[model samples]
Target: MSSSCPTNPSSSTTRPHTYNRKQKSLGLLCTKLGVERRRIYDIVNVLESIGVLARKAKNQYTWKGYAAIPGALHELKEEALREKLEGSQGVNAKVWDDEDDDETLSNSGSQNDKSIPNSDAPKSHKNDNRREKSLALLTQNFVKLFICSNMELISLDDAAKLLLGDAHSSSIMRTKVRRLYDIANVLSSMNLIEKTHTADTRKPAFRWLGLNENQSSNVINSRKRAFGTDISNIDFKRNKVGVFVNGEFSQKPMKQKELEHVSGLGQVDKSNLKHCTKQSSRSYQFGPFAPASVHKVGPSENNSVKQVHDWDSLATVHRPHYQNEALKELFSHYMEAWKSWYSEVAEKKPLHIL
Candidate 1:
């Protein structure tokens, strides 16, 4: 006898709803489920997309309950079918037009030239609109995988492979997963899907709350309870160790008295220190640990004596010596001879050469 059970049993069957009607945070859910913050976001997006959870604010969500799921599924199915029909028609028309254009271009050279400019013009315009792959479009496609597939959940690795092809290197797949993480975060904020371990292998996977009946239990009944705590009011900086006091953690600003106490503990007497008169000397101080002086100087008295002696020797050497009248007349005659030679050469040169 052969068993008629589904190949992949619903994990949600074993995992019962533990959350109540109270508004819960994605962080709290992550902690409770022992899952990463990023995984929690993926789960939340799938849940929110199906009306299982409603977003109230940033990082906050309100339980909308599972009662709305049937209606949500019906709407999704209708939309999906409509899109499928429109896509098929659009694809067929596009193919026909492309084939007709190809035939016309191949048959007539003149028509090809005219069509070339028009085709090239659209391509240029398309190039202008081309942009880097958008995270939003990636997210929509990611969610569509769940919406279109029969699988209730999908692993990030599998999703990455599906979105980015198996031919991509490990680095490329890692990059795609990172981008998916960001998209998952936005979807989580919207409360569509949720992260959970698979039933068979206990590996992480994102369960689609929009379509699966077992996943419907993940939704909590809405209760008119007090408003959820404002996360902005929570002081994360106050407790580095994350110690909770009473019900919440708080960080109070330093009081004036505390500031005064701290300031007084390290107080010093500024007046007791000697003020530096020179800017260059300010960087160093005349202290016990001061380095030995590198410069050597002679005694002032010795310096003065050496200076006097040097000056006297220079004066003696430079003193004027009396010359005989005949020697002076010989020097003057040689100087006149040089001046006459220089004037002759200068005057004989051409005006252009000069």
Candidate 2:
């Protein structure tokens, strides 16, 4: 069976005074669900973006449910339209298609601070930087891209470029893709988006279904995931416990793809994809999530990956039965993450396993 809603959490780190961290929804949910704090943040940010939840107060959020989605999308579409109109009128609209997203997000994040007269300068600056790159804000901006535009399919690389604007460094671009991968997952569970591929390039991309389209099925089976649990969301990351097949729980938690679903980016460039076969090893600028290895470069051989000739089959075979883009990406990570990881590991490694 499939379900169509997601849950969220609300957090505020820069409270004026000390607050109870454990009592917050983020912490409480983590305890109840046995999930890491960061995972809670990911779900919260994406759910809040799609109107499944709303920030009520510090560390609190209201359950808006799936019913709120249509209204929320209407508001987003209208806001996007207004930005377009402003752009046409030379009003310097900052929300969409700005040349540099760093400036745009920084400016957007600081609008509230301008009303304060005596806030600490350093704290405010730090808050601005955090908010500019926040997952919540990025999710909203990504939604605006689909809500306002006519394009049905969008690749994550293109999304990163659009959302990052002119401030796209390899590191920033990689982070953006990882964030987008997460947002796609939460939305995919709700059937708001579907994973597809571009016809011309045959690279994986996502298609918009929003809330209007209807797909109801009891079908719950995939090579990588099981429909047996009847849960709306699937956990791709191994639990905190070690994976011990025969011995003690001594194996590290799924020492697998930290960077998932990157083959579609072709090492951040479609034109350079063919080079993957030629380059056995390349220098990498490791991201925050990169594992430390004495030899940062290695051969391109996928030790245990299934031999798939193309992205289309790879995308289709290893993923869940549903159209959840996140699962599809995760399935390919174990297979292709090896091939692309060393090649694009530095600049384009997605932050976490989705």
Please tell me which predicted candidate would have the highest lDDT against the true structure.
2
In model 1, the worst 10-residue window by lDDT is 276-285
Task: Name the regions of candidate 2 deviating beyond 4 angstroms.
Answer: 1-28, 88-128, 214-354
For model 1 the local lDDT of residue 174 reads: 86
- TM-score of candidate 1 to 2 decimals: 0.30
Clashes of 1: 16
lDDT per residue (tens digit) for residues 1-354 in model 2:
012112221123233343333233344433433345565557766766655455444443444333344444544454444444433343222322222232222322212222233453556455545655667667766766655555556788877776554455798788779889988766654556555666557666776656323221111111211111111122233322121111111222322233224324222332212111110001111112211111111221221111112222222223222233334333233222322322222222221222
Q: After superposition, which runs of candidate 1 have C-alpha atoms over 4 Å from their true positions?
A: 1-132, 211-354
| RMSD for each of the candidates | 43.1, 18.9
Kindly report which residue pairs in candidate 2 clash with one another. Answer: 285-346
What TM-score, computed on C-alpha atoms, does each candidate reach? Answer: 0.30, 0.48
